[model samples]
Target: MSAQDSVPTPAATAPIDPIPTTSTPDINAAPHDPEDPETGEIEDPDNESSRFYGPEPDSNPSDGDSALGDYRSTRSTSVSSYVYDYQYENGRRYHARRYSTEYDLPNDEKESDRLDLQHHLFLLTLSGALHRAPISKNVQEVLDVGTGTGIWAIDFADQYESSKVTGTDLSPIQPAFVPPNCQFYVDNMEEDWTFDHKFDYIHGRMIVVGMRNWERFFQQCYDNLHPGGWVEIQDLNFPLRCDDGTAGPESPPMTWSSLMIEGAAKLGVDLSASNRFRDIMSNVGFEEVTVEHHAWPINSWPKDQNEKEKGMWVLQNVLEGLQGFSMGYYTRGLRWRAEEVDVFLASVRERMKDKRSHVYLPIGVFYARKPMGI
Candidate 1:
């Protein structure tokens, strides 16, 4: 195996291109009422303009607002129990550490549901494609790192029936009933990899917080792949972006995100690693590296139909994930009390529900390939 010291420095990659956030649709805009001259069918009203009905008169502003339309802003245990035992903090469950304490996310039923919901959001963004990599149909030997819930691996295995899929994670939370060709292993990628075979495609998604040494992780992916193989990573950039000056550095979303980044850094985890995956892959000797960016609005602030729909789902995912995402970082890393963490998160949640904030998360999808002559 190559040493981490040998990894070369890579040139900087392109900056994240900002997409224009659609302005708030005017509710008083004239509604469409004209009928089609040819078919005499009534034209449907503009969905974007009609999506936000605004807050009700009787609703309390402090009660919070929903991203959809209505207003409302709403781990533990043992070593041998690593399989059966779990740890609980602030009423949330986290997977017991088997080898490392690098991971900070929970693995219980709530997080599992959020993970699946995130997968659905990815599919919606990708137009139902499993991957953006252009691998051959005859390709086999696929591996999914940090495969929480084994949903992505299961779906990939089902799509590419001819290929074998292996998913590895610290928790044995994946379902036992899976595709015949798909298998799950309770292992940590930070440790020495013991795979007996090379793969044609390697994938990792939403794994930025789980890794302590991304250079080593990418080097392992490069080493464990065939000479001409592919690798892909999907994750969100940190410290939320806002175009309208609504969510500045002092805003709730930015404040909490920055705190989390600081906390994760104290634990040797990079919450903003997605911003540098391209450079890391290049430095690790991967060729033809490329990255694509997507917009994840914090609420239903976007005027475009597609982005608004995406925003609605993203809102729910973020709201559900706020507690789990903060518990580990705030309590263990930042040395904050559980109650303090909860109080801070409540303010962040309320801020997230406000469309006027115009906060959004930048999503990055990175892909690369091993040189054929390597």
Candidate 2:
């Protein structure tokens, strides 16, 4: 059966199910009032002093690195004010100004640095390819959604000098210096798009957490693309897998994944939403849809040389950001205390380091073309 025939079309006005609520604080709840002055209790959601932990210190604070040392470091620049101003909650910082609280990731400098590392890791995974989509090099216009730090868009612009690239994100955390053909916009994509021109190519990477309605988001991509234009989505499916059964349900990584998935579900965020991208794109009037699956090992367990190298990068990527990734979701969605979340993650980190566990995540890449007649 064709992809289009396999999926049912969703009602446009259908009400999305709310994420299951827990005793913990509502993910969308407004910030609490300022701390109690006399009691010295931290009540304000924006109070940085009340953070459960201090910011993770950078091991190599300098931008440069030894040739043989860790991954290649990109020339880092200061965050720009063009992005949304930052706000803090439970000591973790987030985009202060946005259309909604759809995004759960941090928007601070540390997060940006991690995102840069993630970009390089992705490049390594794809063997330096920016995307798996069979897009034409002559394509004139491109739109990069959730273009954190604008690294991908900048690279795209640099590669396709003739093409104009526009990167948009909720936080104005991207660098000020960029290619001449590239520009950054601080905009929420979930809202009605008012771009003056349709794009020849649209790209979104690791934006699963930022979208509430996958069907609607795909429709928007369809509507915004020019005839025969292409859209590519790269995302990771959650709940790390164990092929060897060593890392079972009782394992720390597995346990952490379950809790994180639960937290995301309660917030109406579908971490595994990428699994349906092929069907959704086909149903949304797209054509020639294709899906490519890649496995990202949680540790260096693969015997093959290339897979082992990729595994190492993936391991480092996760280990470095594990705490930041867990803080918001656990504290807000699961309603766990900050210290409790930290302790749980410490155990999870140890589990991730175990080669016997053989845990890995599935990375999904979906690409489709807008029908020429549409």
Candidate 3:
């Protein structure tokens, strides 16, 4: 690897307590008046019941039924590999990159299915919008970095017939039949970009785990994009969070996230880099850098209609993705036995199915633009 592509030494991975826990609020209790002499304690700003949901009406935080319905009933898609050569480990297939850098997830058919499911989950989150950027309809070229199954690229090409979409990844696991305007290539984003023409818009999703030098990655994006073009990154902030104290430190999600963050850092990648994309993009000379904070509830514990639906899909996505997300990382970086890894993952699966646990993954969506007349 070139010096420019070298991964930065990450700080020590800490425990998985991203959100500070507070006492559970009583939904059915009467309101407390500040002037009342009977009430002894005035609630502090940090202890407000509305800390998690700003300006929303107060409701039962733990009101959802404990039953975790059949999340597998959601629709799923399948993929086939165009490239025959692959590397197998722990009975999972990996990319035949033949390079020093390794990816955290497998590239098998099961992982491809999970990627497609995750793409749908994003659609449900965004309410079916392909992107949040305000690009014009005349956009000529588009690029998707680390496009796992090429699902997003295919949809973009179908939506914008005037644009040509290119998807790149380390594995040739994308299907053969796709929109005429969309194409897929097996390549690495950390290397120097060699596209023949600059693009009008670029998008990357869930690529934080495989990336090394995020600054260099954004710099390459800036160099390869036309002036005034936009770039968007969608990723999940690591170390699962809990608004309530139900999913505590001993929870399976917390344990998994802590170990995964440490293991990824040891392997020269930062799992928490999603939290730094906005600052990094601005430092890279991009203008109008903006980020949106969102949450993906682990199960159907939420009360809102849309959020409840999202929770169901997110639960299925996590359940199907856990093994592929951990196998390579544990064995390679953390040095764990294959059987031990399986035993630990079994507990995670069981814990994830509990709807009353109230765990969620924080998501970040960052978008920026290259300055014009540069």
Residues 1-374 of candidate 1: C-alpha lDDT, one tens digit per residue: 21231111110111222322212222322111212121111122122111122111112223243433532211111123233457777888777655655578998878877787777677755556678789989779999988887778888988899999988777776654567888877677887775778999999998987788889999999999999999998876676777567778998889998999999888888888866677789999999887766667776666554555667778988998999988898888999999999899999999998877777776667789999988
Q: Model 3, range 1-374, lDDT digits (tens) per residue?
A: 13233221111111221222211111222212323322111222222222222111114544354333443312122233133357889999898765556787898868877787787677666656678778879888999988887778877898899999988877666555567888776677887777678999999999998999999999999998999999998887787777667778888878998998888888988888876676789899999886655667777666554566667678889888898899888888899998999999999888877766777776667789999997
User: lDDT per residue, candidate 2, 86-166, as tens digits?
Assistant: 778767678865466457888776777678778876776565778877888887999998898778998899888889998
User: When superposed on Cα atoms, how far off is each prediction in RMSD?
Assistant: 13.0, 17.0, 11.7
- Where is model 2 more than 4 Å wrong at Cα? 1-68, 80-85
> Which residue pairs collide in model 3, if any?
none
Q: Give each model's whole-structure lDDT.
A: 0.70, 0.69, 0.71
Clashes of 3: 0
Instruction: Kindly provide the TM-score of model 1 when superposed on the true structure, using C-alpha atoms.
Output: 0.79
Model 2: per-residue Cα lDDT at residue 237: 76
